[model samples]
Target: MSKDYPALTRDIAQYTGELRKLVPETMHSFYALSRAAGANGRIDAKTKELIALAIGITQRCDGCIGFHIKALHGMGASREEVAEVAAMSIYMGGGPALMYAADALRAFDQFDVPAV
Candidate 1:
């Protein structure tokens, strides 16, 4: 079955907000770590997002795949670029990664559509 990535991310965000309220200090630290990791240095933001996407695929985390793909889409990542990252993830992670990689590509396509 196909997933509604946009809706999935939205639901995740809603729950994440609740989690943040319960553990504001931890959530705040996590946010800071995320920001610092994603910050541009030698690597650009787009490339960092691609790396995150690949990691998400390998880890088989649907929420990570959805969020990272959405970020890549917002950064103007091409389908080809996402596919290349998926390929790399599959190579490193074998069959399980292959499944999540496909989901990641699906997430990319989902984000590609213009909202009506």
Candidate 2:
């Protein structure tokens, strides 16, 4: 079954806000590392987000799936692009990955993105 992605996104935001308050320095460090990882290098930010989305499916991390899908949506990734990444995840991870790929696609479809 797929998750309610809008709810997931909202919950993540709330949880992150609370976590930041609890450990602001660690949270800032984590955010800095995340930014560094996503910075333009051999791969662009959009590609990195797509890779993160695929890995989230492979790893079956619902929170990771929500985060990366939101990032991909914000980056203007098409549904077809998400599908391609999902296909690769399925190929790499087999049946279980297929299940989470469905979840990822559901998030991609339902996640609320702000208009640019």
Candidate 3:
């Protein structure tokens, strides 16, 4: 069955907020690190999000895919761009990655932000 990307994102955010409250210092540090890692550097944020999406696919992490797809959609990534990234993820990770890559593409297409 297809997942609901927007609802998944909202749930993640709500759960994460509660987790943050439960472990304020730890969650704060993790959030700080996440922001730092996602900051634009040699690679632009768009490319970085693509890379993250690929990693998410390769790792088979649904939450990771949702987050990265949302970020990619927000950054105005094209469907073609997402497809190319998914291709690379499949190349690197083989069969298991294929499943998550499909999921990632679906998430990208269903995200609230439009693809370019």
| TM-score per candidate, chains pooled | 0.97, 0.91, 0.92
Error of 3 at 7 (Å): 1.2
Candidate 2 residue-wise lDDT, 13-46, digit = tens: 9989999999999999999999999988999999
- Pick the lDDT winner: 1
Worst 10 residues of 1 by lDDT: 107-116
lDDT per residue (tens digit) for residues 16-81 in model 3:
999989999999999899888889999888888888889889999899999988887778888889
Poorest lDDT segment (10 consecutive residues) of candidate 3: 107-116
The residue pairs that clash in candidate 2, if any, are none
Q: When superposed on Cα atoms, how far off is each prediction in RMSD?
A: 0.8, 2.3, 2.6
| Runs in model 2 lying further than 4 Å from the true structure | 112-116
Summarize candidate 1's per-residue lDDT along 1-116 as a digit string, tens digits. Answer: 88899899999999999999999999999999999999999999889999999999999999999999999988989999999999999999999999999999899888888988
> By TM-score, who's the top model here?
1
Cα lDDT over the full model 2: 0.90
lDDT of 1 at 88: 99
How many angstroms is residue 27 displaced in model 1 relative to the true structure, after the best TM-score fit?
0.6
Q: Cα miss at 62, model 3 (Å)?
A: 0.6
- Superposed by TM-score, candidate 3 places the C-alpha of residue 116 at a distance from the truth, in angstroms, of 20
